[model samples]
Target: MDLAFGADDSKKRKGPSKNWTEREIEEELKKLDAKIEDAKTNSGDVEVRDAILDKAMFLKQEARDYPEAEKVFREAYVKSGGASKKMELLFEILLMNIEKFDIDSVKKDVTLCKQLVDEGADWDKKNKLKIFEGVYCMLIRDLKRAAELFMSSIATFTCVELMEYKDFVFYTVVTAMVTQDRKTIRKEVVHSPDILAVIRDIPFLRQYMESFYNCEYKQFFEAFVEIIDAIKRDKYLQTHANYFIKEMRLVAYRQYLESFKSVTIENMARAFGVQPDFIDKELSNFIYIGKINCKIDKVSGVIESNRPNKKAELFTNTIKSGDALLNRIQKLARALDI
Candidate 1:
């Protein structure tokens, strides 16, 4: 497992297996098989355990036989003695599962990684684990945590094996825009030196962040429209594209409407670079579904903010989430009891 990811141009990151010819692959596997068979007697040796794990990586990266590879990986973990060695092998297994997008396995493996990390892994290892956890979160569409992890790891990012640095920033901005409030976005993201360094290279992404925070509604709408296709085509985000877009729109609309008690429909439409009729229909639909807290004066073509009490809303949300968590725990306990 080559984890030397100290490169600015992570584009050259490629698995060694990709370069091996079919004949070479077959020859290498045969050699590894002999070594593995022989190493079984000397399995207590650290070097023998490493060779066993190497064979596991070969199966994972080349043969793509996940079950067998995972079996070998777990066997290697059980035989391995050193904490560092265990963590290294764990990362190998985690990355292999991640490539396959095996969400359930990822969740299980990440929990183990957390245990290993907490016991002895250094700060660098912990930061790298954040990248792994962040990627797992993305696969599961838990973008809020994913955003937080990515943002925190930006300055010390070394997960180019999972995704390039630029792509990491892209995910950070995309998730943060919908999940973070204006103040946090301004402080953590807009002012982030790591984000600012690479944001210009990505198309429409900078505008997407700046316009929203700066209250440039028309630019924000245009930037969002420009980037919508990319979001829809994304591997991790595409599944949640509709949800993400709707949340973003609600955020933008709420931000704008929160500034005023009442605003004319025509002004709102003009602000967003859309027709009044379009705005009317969109707002009506959002309001009807309780996505936005605002009332429309159809006769006067005005939209009035019906913002709820912030403290009450926070308390209600906390209670609801707590109840949901308790329900899940109870169900899991019942399942275990069986």
Candidate 2:
């Protein structure tokens, strides 16, 4: 499976797959339908029905009939009344339906997975479920939660042998960058030698991590663009490219704000290679959302950074020191009396 996403700029992430001949597909579907009908008619066992449906789903998937596979998986999962094996099948359905980018189905499956975890599902299954849930959050533009979830699953990724390990690590780094959560990266990603080894080999991921960590905003943006370009060809990621771009831009904006006292929107835009109005709009959004402690002067077209109140901070620190000294003196006096 060549999951190495191409830099395809097309918005349509999927194309027809000639996995099976039409006649072969029709023959398999007919056989699976008869089997399913017989199972329903002769067997009252829900497991038997679910196994038959699963076989039908496999045939659909083999024929690259993703929509039909999704339908069959959903029916089997629901009709089985939450069987454990069906939950695994449901995850397959989630993977197959990525082109549709259905948030509702993802959420429903996440809820079911959480319930399964609570009921003592294996740690490996729980870890995979968490990663999938993080993907759901990313698709929904919840970058902060996505970063947290990805970071929390780092240990699992280290111990587990996942076929999609490359995508998992790539998204982990991407989500952390989008949210600008360096502390989490430092703790969860950088310190883990296992993940570090994997990332060091991948040029783009390595560049992203180094650029972000080294405060090379321009390099970071360039590498980010490359990442986004590659992601655009992926069936699951293309749907959220715009949102991902917006979040990554905010990260760059935040980094720039930290280094300068104030900067004109035009100048910042020029530095970032974007339009002045786009930078202004982003700065305005950050201010509105309380994501950045800054003020935008619309008339001057500059964003002024909100410096901390050093005087107030000094006074608070002085008070804390005084209280600490007084406590020490009291302890000394008690010792002397004793």
Candidate 3:
């Protein structure tokens, strides 16, 4: 599915509505509207919900009336019966709404969907929601949580309605690379049989992950450029392309720097397949922000790792966190001292 990189592998657009003319679609939608009225008149709630669902789908696909479609979808959900029925109907509603990427609405609907699933929804339904929610998390820039959700659902991916299996694998691997630690990425993404099965089909993405893992910085940098292009083209990731690219470059640079107390700037550039000046400028910005924890010797043209001692860093962070918490508590106490 290389969903972010290219066209979707297959969409669950079930109907000839797309092939029909506007007038033809309008005529067919009118017929479905009549069917909905007939179901309300002579059939059960299930029949009415089914009829409304049909109309909603028609509006979404044929008429291209998303607002109307969503309204009708809500009608179907309202008519839906029991936990299972509501779960099914809600997922339908979710798919339509998620396409719009209305962030606040998605958050609320996903939360509601979670609640419904918790009320004993089937395993299949639960797994499906995980993928949807994972995609939603990715869209919102919560890469860590999105990676967690995506990795958890890989073996049981059945969200064909949401995306193709290969696309799911793509999202899972990309997010894992950025947000997951090396050991976790090795365990959950690099060596996962489910991911390995189709990863080669996504050649650049495979290179992006595997090259970094294998310490092939040259290959990783080559793949990184291709991936940035794909991310720029992706509707879901376009907004985050610059951010993602910068982060990934840092991932490569940090990994390379971790192995050396000091490395010549020219050597570091050669390793990343970039120019010495480019590496110097890149490392300077990161070092200024304390992002890379490194020092650059301009005259000697050497880059030095200034990473703090792990235990000392950890202790400093703990004390800072505790002091911040205590200040907040003291502030509260002073306000209530009366």
Candidate 4:
């Protein structure tokens, strides 16, 4: 944990203490604080001051006093002239309390992260900062941006680098599902075979994707339920769980509608494991908004697609074929001219 200060005087004096009580840690921090002040006044050695502050920061974190730890880290970071590790840790401390961060603080950290990356910080640190930005976006309820940032971070990483970030990928997939932006998701997530493989490694993710792809509305809902705890744990998802659930249901309902010329509300309700009333309301919501391109026949209890009639469909297909044939002949004529 004390990566910055590898050697400490206490450790050399009495090997390393395996178990230090809270009182002992507090005492150590008090002594280190005094030494840090003395080093500032007497030796004026920034390195010595930074080392003392690092030990104090470590002890503060161990004592679960994160605000105090952040103060110590900020001081050390200033003395060290913005060392990469210290800068990364500073951002990390902010990320740990993302919900408490204000919009200005979040924006400041984002700018710092970009500056660090431009100055050639390590890949691990870069990805960590990128993930922090994504988490910040999630905390702010900007899910579309969060999904894109998470994708960019993971896309540049090797498989070895991705193991530590499986949870982030889970967040990205859930964001994609919630936003239902298939164009972006397909380009960013599904098209990347390696990333897809990494994603499928999670058992629940695999189930969700399989069921969603196969349009198994019931199975997809079950898969979502299985990961409900995870959704609750995430700050953004927990806040918008109802919205996500509602949107995903519409997606499932639309897919179900694609398979039928007409289906009863009761039957659709059975497939989605919802009450017929709920299905009726959801269908009305989508249909009114032109999302489902369908109508419900209340007397017949049937929901139907407003697709073209057979003759109209045939005429549309013929026009499309003719256009394609004309384009091909133009290409052939150009080749002949060449």
Best-fitting candidate, measured by lDDT? 3
Give the poorly placed runs of model 3, Cα more than 4 Å off.
Answer: 1-26, 321-337
The digit string of per-residue lDDT tens for model 1 on 1-338 reads 12122222224544455667778878988898789778767664776777778889887777666788888999899988756667777787787777667888889988987888778877767888898898888778788999898888878998666777877888888888888887878888999999999888888889999999999999999999866777777666777778888888988988899899999999999999999999999899999999888999989999998989999999999999999999999999999999
- Winning candidate number (TM-score): 3
Q: Model 2 lDDT vs. the true structure?
A: 0.71
Model 2 scores worst on lDDT over the 10 consecutive residues at 6-15
Candidate with more favorable, higher lDDT: 1 or 2: 1
Clash counts for the predictions, in order: 0, 0, 0, 0
Indicate whether candidate 2 or candidate 4 has the larger TM-score.
4
Across residues 1-338, which tens digit of lDDT does each residue of candidate 2 receive?
Answer: 23344223133323334567889778877877777788778877685666667564565546767777777776776676544555676677666443356788778878887887787766667777777787788677786787788788876663222225666777777777667466767777767665686786565778778777787766776777777776676545677788777777777778778889988888877777678887788788878888788998989888899976999989999999999999999999999999
Better of 2 and 3 by TM-score: 3
lDDT at 176, model 3: 87
Better of 1 and 4 by TM-score: 1
Q: Please report how far candidate 3 places residue 117 from its true position, in Å.
A: 1.3
Candidate 1 residue spans exceeding 4 A from truth: 1-13, 16-27, 40-44, 309-338
Model 1 pairs in collision: none
Residue 307 C-alpha lDDT in model 2? 70
- Worst window of 10 by summed lDDT in candidate 3: 1-10
lDDT of 4 at 214: 64
Model 3 scores what on Cα lDDT?
Answer: 0.83
